[model samples]
Target chain A: MLSPGIMGRSLLDKVWDLHTVRELPSGQTQLFIGLHLIHEVTSPQAFAALRDAGGAAAGPPGHHAGGAAAGPLGHKAGLRVRRPDRTFATVDHIIPTDSQARPLGDALAEEMLQHLERNCAEHGIAFFGPGSGKQGIVHVIGPELGLTQPGMTIACGDSHTSTHGAFGAVAFGIGTSQVRDVLATQCLAMARPRVRRIDVAGKLSPGVYAKDVILAIIRRLGVKGGIGYAYEYGGPVIDAMTLEERMTVCNMSIEGGARCGYINPDEATFAYLRGREFAPQGEAFERAVQWWRGIASDPDAVYDDRIELDGARLAPTVTFGITPGQSVGVDEPIPSPADVPADERAGIEEALAFMALEPGKPITGTPIDVAFIGSCTNGRISDLREAARVAQLGTVAPGVRTFVVPGSQEVQRQAEAEGLPAVFRAAGFDWREPGCSMCLAMNPDKLRGRELCASTSNRNFKGRQGSPTGRTLLMSPAMVAAAAIRGHVVDVREEL
Target chain B: MSSEAKVERVEGRGCVLRGDDIDTDRIIPARFLRCVTFDGIGAHAFEDDRLQAKGNHALDDPRFAGASILLVGRNFGCGSSREHAPQALWRFGFQAFVGESFAEIFFGNCVAMGLPCVTLPRAELTRLMDSVDLDPQQRLVLDLASGTITSKLGTQAIAMPDGARRQLLEGAWDATAVLLAGGDAIDATADSLPYVRGFAA
Candidate 1:
C-alpha cells in the first residue's frame, strides 16, 4: 500500500490542479467551475442577490486587461452570467408533474419559475422550461444531455449536484450565495476535502441495487462520517455498474454527509457519453476518452482513509428513520434503543417516535399508504423499467396510492415509446410528468397526514415528502413497486 | 464588498439547541422555500420543530427568543444545501455559531453569508451549551482573530479551517468579489483544459 502524502496523486488532485484559477489570500483555492446547473427553487434568491449587489459577469471589470476576447468583461451595468455558454437552467423543484400549465396552481411556484425564465433570458443562458423536451431534474438532464462530462467541476444551488460526480467530475452542491458567486465570477472559493476510497467488492445479491449499496455504506459510515471528505467509490461492483446505476449511487452522496462522491471514468462511462446531445463528435470523442482515461486515479494513489464492504452480503435496504444512515435490511428489525449505546440511543428513539415505528419489530410488513417511484436518485428509464417489471406481477394493493414519475422529459419520452407507462398504469400506479415530483415535495405531490410512503427518492428526512408528519422510507424503485403491490414494506426479492 | 464588512467579533446572548445531525429540513422545511425571496423567513426558522414542541422548543421558549448566538451539537446542519436554513437562522437573529461540527455544505453556506461557524470539542460544546442554558441571558463573545469563544463562565478555544478563519476575519467571506478578481487566471485555466472546448482544442 502507498503511504499517505506519497508521490501518487488521486483523480481529485489532478482535476483540482487543472481547474485552479489561483490560490486566494484566504488559503482557499479560487477554482474555475466548468459547468453550472440551476433550478427554480434555489436560484431566485441567488439571482436576487447578484442583482442587488450590482455585480457584473467575471468581476468588477479591469481584472483582466487582455484576457480571452470572448470573456464577459466590463459589463458593470448589471449582473450577467459570466459563462452563459456553460450555464443551464431548468424548473424542477416547484413544478407540478400533474400539469405543466402556466399560471401554475401554486402562485409562488409560478412566480419562482417566471423569475428563472427571466433570469435565463436576460443573461443569455439556456432555459429548458416546460415543453422544451429537455426539462427535468437539473441532475437528471445534465447527464442525459451529456453536459456532465468527466474532469469537469459542476455546481448547482441544489444539494444533489453531487449526482454529476458519477462521470468523474469534481462536482459539489453549493449554497445560494455560492451560486451567486459562480454566476458572477465563474469560480468558487473553496477549501478542498480529503478523499476517502470506499471499495465494495463482490457481486450484489439478487434484488439488491445501487440504492442498496449506498444505503449500506451510509448505514455503516453514519450520516456525518463523510464530512470533510470526498468519497471515491471503486472495486469490481462499481466497475460493472451502468452509468445510470453509478448515478444512483452518487446522487445520494449528500445523504451520507459527503458533499461530493465520484467513480473513475471507465469504458462504460465513455460508451454512455458517446453520441449524446452535448458530447463530442466522432474523432473528438475518441480524444475525449483518451483524456478522460488519463484523469482516473493512479493505481498507487494515496487516500486519507479507506473502507471496504462486500457487495454480495448486502441485502435490500430501507430507511426507517429520519436520516438515511438509520436504515436496516428489509427483513431486519428496527433497532431498539436498548441495543444502541447511550449516546446513540437518543437519535434512534427520536427517529422511531417521529416515524411512529415500533422498536425491535421487523421493518417488513410495515404498512404503507403511498408508494413513490421517482427522484434524481432513481427516476431514469432503467429504474422505471425495473419497477415496471415488478409492476407486471400484481395490481397495487387497495387504498394504496402509487406514483411512478420519470426523471426527465427524455426519460419520460423513452419510457412512453417503450410502453412502460401503460404497464405502470395497468398495475394501478399513477404515471406522472417529469420534475422532482414528491422528492422534496415542493410541488403538488405530497404525503397526507401521518401517511407512510415507500419512496425511491434520496433523503428520508422528516417532512421531506411535504407533510410535517409524513413518513418516508427510502428504497429502490423495484422495492417500491413490490411495496405498492403489497401495501407494506416487503422485500422485492420475495415478490420476484 | 468592503474590509469593514468583515466579521471579526460576535458578542451576544446564546441559545442552545441540543441534538446531533439536526438537519436543514428541521431548521426550515421545504414548504417555506417557495418564496422568490428570503424575506420574512425568520418567522419560520425551526417552524415545524417549534410547532411540534408547542412553545417548549428552544426557538419558541421565551428565554431564548431574542438570542443572537447559537450553540448546537455535532453535525448541526446535516442535510440539504438550501441556503434557506441558514438564511432563516440569520434572519431569526443568529450571528455566530459554536458547535461540535457542521455539515460541509451548511458550513460553506454560513461562511458565504458572512456568518462565522466555529467548532469546539464535544465536551467543550456540551459545557458551553449547558452554560448558556443555565444562564440564558449571559452574553458570549467570539473573536475570530483570537479563535476563542468567551463568556462569564470562562473562555475556550474554538477551531475552524485557517482559510475560513482568514476569510471571516478579513471580511472576504462573501467570495464573489475575491473570485472575480481572478478573471484572467480563470480564463487561462479554462482555455488549458481540453474538455472545456469539447476536446477539439
Candidate 2:
C-alpha cells in the first residue's frame, strides 16, 4: 500500500507514486509511464513484435483470447496496451526541413516517412507529418504545442526527450521495444533513478548561452557523471532563465549521463504555457497552475547528491575533442597530450590526430568548413534571433558553408516574419526549414571528409555529423554565427 | 534439444586501439541504423570517414583488413543509445572491445547482446595497439572465464563490473535470465501482495 505522504501529492511525487507498480529486488522502483512518443527510426521492430503477437492471438478462440493473450502480455498484466489517445507520432528525421513536398529525395527515407504516416493512421494515433505546420522535431513540437506539460511522464524513442523535463515533467528516452510496449500499453515498467540537483548560482556571461553552460557541466562532471540519476537543475541561474533557456539546458541532460534533467515549474513556466495550443484554459488553466505550483520542491527537499557551480564563471565554451565532455573554454588552449591525465592521454592523442589539431594550440584560429545553427538544442526562434544579431553585423566568410535550420515550421514562420532569414541569407547562410538537420546527419545535411564544423547542436562525438572523420566543434548559436562569418573558430564574446 | 548446442566462438589476440570519446555513430552510422536485424552491419561499421581518407576509400587500404579486436580511446560508444553499434560490431566478427571507458547505454547494450566490453588504463591500450601494429599475428587470449584479456607481449585484467560476464559466457541476450533469477522472490511477493490495477478502460 502507498502512504498518503507519498501519494496524491506534488506533480513529481504524484506521477512517481502512481507509477510505482512494484519494487524490484534490486531496490529499483518499477514505475509505470503515462505516455510514449515514437518516431520512424526506432519503431520498426517493436511494431513487428506487436503485430506478431496480435496475429498469434487471433488464431484459436479460447487459446488465443485467454491464456495465450496473457502470454503475450508478459508476466505483468498491467503492462498491456491500453490507451492510444495518450500515444502520438511525429516524423522529424529524414524529412528535409527545407521542403515538405512528397517523394523525398531519398526513396528509402520517403518509404519510411510514408510507412509511419500509414501506421499512425491505421492505429488511429495522432501523427504530426511534414505538411503539418505543427510538425517539427518531436522534442521541439511537444512543448511548443503544450502537448507536454507539468506532472506528465513522457517517453520518446529519441534520447533528448528529456527536454520535456523543462516543464516539470518526468521525461526520458527509451528503445524501440520500450516504445512498442508504451504504444500497446500506456504504461512502461521502468526502474526509478536517483535524483541529483545541479544547482547553478550567480549570473551568466553575455556571450555564454545555455549551450555553453551545459557543455561546461558535461566537462566538469565527465560524460558518465549522471549515470542512473535524474538531474534537477535549480538555484539562481536556472531560476533567472526563460523557459526556452531552461529547455536548452535540460535538452542535453543525457549527454552528461543523466536519464533526465528538469526545472521546477514557476511563473515563467506557467506564463509560457498560458495560451498555448493544448494547455488548459480558463478555470482549468488556473487549476493546472495551482497543481503545478504545488509540485515545486519543498523548501527542504533533499537530493541524493548535489553539485553547485558559479554560472557567471562559465565562458563561451567549445568542444575540443570528440565527446561533449572533452571541451575547453573559448579562451583556453587545446590540451596537450602531456597535460592530460595518464588515463586520458590516449584520447587526447587520438582526438588530435583525428581532428588534425596540434596540442597546446589556440582553438580560436582553427578553421571551419561549415557552421550549423539548428537542432532541438538551439534551433528555437530565440536562438535564431541571437544568431541573426551576429549575422546582421557581418557577412559569412568565403568558402564557408553555413546553414540556419529552425526547430519547427512555426519558428520558421516567426523568424521569417521577423526577417531573421533575410539577415542570415544576406550573410551567406542557407536558411533552411525546421527539422533535426545535420544534428546526427539523418537527413541530406552532412559534412564532407575531414571537414570541421562549428555547430550549435549537442554532441561532438567523432563522426556524429555523418562523415566518420568529420570533426564537430560544439558551441553556442552566436559562436557558430561568429565562426560562420570568420570561417574559423572565433570567440563570440570578442564580437559582443 | 541437445545439451551441447552449437555455439560458435571466435578468438584472437586482442588489439587495443585507444582514443577518447568514440560515439555510437562512429561505431555504426545512422544510415545503417534502420535495419531490423543485425545482419551484415559489421562490414559497414565505421563506414564513414574512418575507413576512408580524403578523396580515397578506406576499404581499399589493407591496413585495417581482418582487424578483429578494436581498441578504442576513452568514453567509447558515447553518443546515441543505439544498440545497432554492438550489433554491427558483432556482425563484423569483433569478439571483444577493449576501451579505456564506455558510455553507459552503449556499455549496457554490449552486455545485453553478449559482447565483451573490457575497460583498461589508457597506457595499456596504447601499448597493446602498438604491439598489434608491430605484429598482427600476436596472440591475445580473451579468457571469458576470468574476465581477463591477455596479449603475448603483456597481460591486463579487465573488469565487467555488473556480472555481465556470466551473460556473455552463457550467450543469452534476452532479459529472461534476469527475470528467472528473481522469479522466486517475485512469485512470493505477488502471492502476498494484492493486485491493484490503475489504468482507465
lDDT of each: 0.89, 0.73
Per-residue lDDT over A1-496 for candidate 2, one digit per residue giving the tens place of the 0 to 100 score? 5554653233455457645555544343444455567777776656654555443232233332222335443522212233456677887877775687889887877877877876676566788887778888888888888878776778887788889999898997765545654555444444566788888999998998988888999898988788767888988999998888988999999899887788899999999989897777777778777767776776566678889999989999998887788899989999998996776677778777878888778899899999999998998989999999999879999999888999988888999899998899888899997888899888888888889999999988777887777899999999999999988999999996
Each prediction's TM-score versus the true structure? 0.97, 0.82
Lowest lDDT sum, 10 consecutive residues, model 1 chain A, at A62-71
Candidate 2 CAPRI category: incorrect
Q: What DockQ do the predictions score, one after another?
A: 0.71, 0.20
Q: Which candidate is the best by lDDT?
A: 1
Chain A vs. true chain A, TM-score per model, equals 0.96, 0.92
Q: What TM-score would candidate 1 get against the native?
A: 0.97
Scored by TM against the true chain B, the candidates give 0.97, 0.77
Off by over 4 Å in 2: A1-15, A24-28, A54-81, A187-189, B1-17, B34-39, B49-74, B94-101, B108-201
Residue lDDT tens for model 1, A1-496: 7675677878899999999999999999999999999999888888776666643333445554212232355544445667889999998899998989889999989999889999888778999999798999899999999999999999999889999999999998998999998987788999888999999999998799999999999999998999989999999899989999999999888888897999999999999998899999989999999999999999988899999999999999999999999999988899999988787888999999999999989999999999999899999999999999999999999999988899999999999999999999999999999999998888999999899999999988888898989999999999999999999999899889
